[model samples]
Target: MNLIELSPEGNFESWEISRLKELRAEEFSKELGQSMLYENDEFRLWDITLKHKERLTFRRVVNDFSYTCITDGFGVIHLGNGKIQFGQFKKGDICSFNMKENEELILDVENTGLGILKFIVTELKLK
Candidate 1:
């Protein structure tokens, strides 16, 4: 939502993403035009942001892993020990994939809009 605008100079940590103190989906829906639709015991919500050249390392904590749409900017993601693929992603793109504990992702932001990433995970850890 428009609530947590991240800093442009700081890297991101999935654990640092903030959760609504009151868990008010209604307010988010009203402001952002959509809100958290579903959450169960198996998944926890995550919302994060990254500036250009700022990367975050994340590990899958759930079996059914999924990423929500990117709300702002574009980026290229690099897996652990892999080259930064020429591929790029922009806003409104959603993806799902399998990841291992040893795998890591480094998001290379290519825009100044700030990369907004949201997803659901149960037990993610910083690697």
Candidate 2:
């Protein structure tokens, strides 16, 4: 997987961004075990928690231009019909997506030990 550290200037380096793209491409049908984070215009932060190092599977459907991130944990996110993107998420990580349609954001926790925080976007923005 391609790894990139957030830049001090808040802009990702060219090489690092390219590497992130590669990682996103290779994330077909793979289960991820780590903390997840995302943000949009209305909210500044959203944290998805994983318990006992559990796994979350991300699947992309090329024909539909959509993807799904399924966690046996807890979280909420806007779904859409566009090129799905993902990367290795850690504490303080953030990403944004454009919502083309009204989508359902579902949160499920398989174990009581897991917890998460979700945010919704009222305005369209990416940073």
lDDT of each: 0.37, 0.30
lDDT of 1 at 74: 53
Error of 1 at 23 (Å): 35
Q: Give the candidate number with the greatest lDDT.
A: 1
Q: What is the lDDT of candidate 1?
A: 0.37
Ten residues in sequence with the least summed lDDT for candidate 2? 76-85
Query: TM-scores for all candidates?
Result: 0.41, 0.23
Residue pairs with backbone overlap in model 2: none
What are the clash counts of all predictions, listed in order? Answer: 0, 0
- Quote the lDDT for 72 in model 2: 25
Task: List the RMSD of every prediction in angstroms.
Answer: 12.5, 13.2
In lDDT terms, how accurate is model 2?
0.30
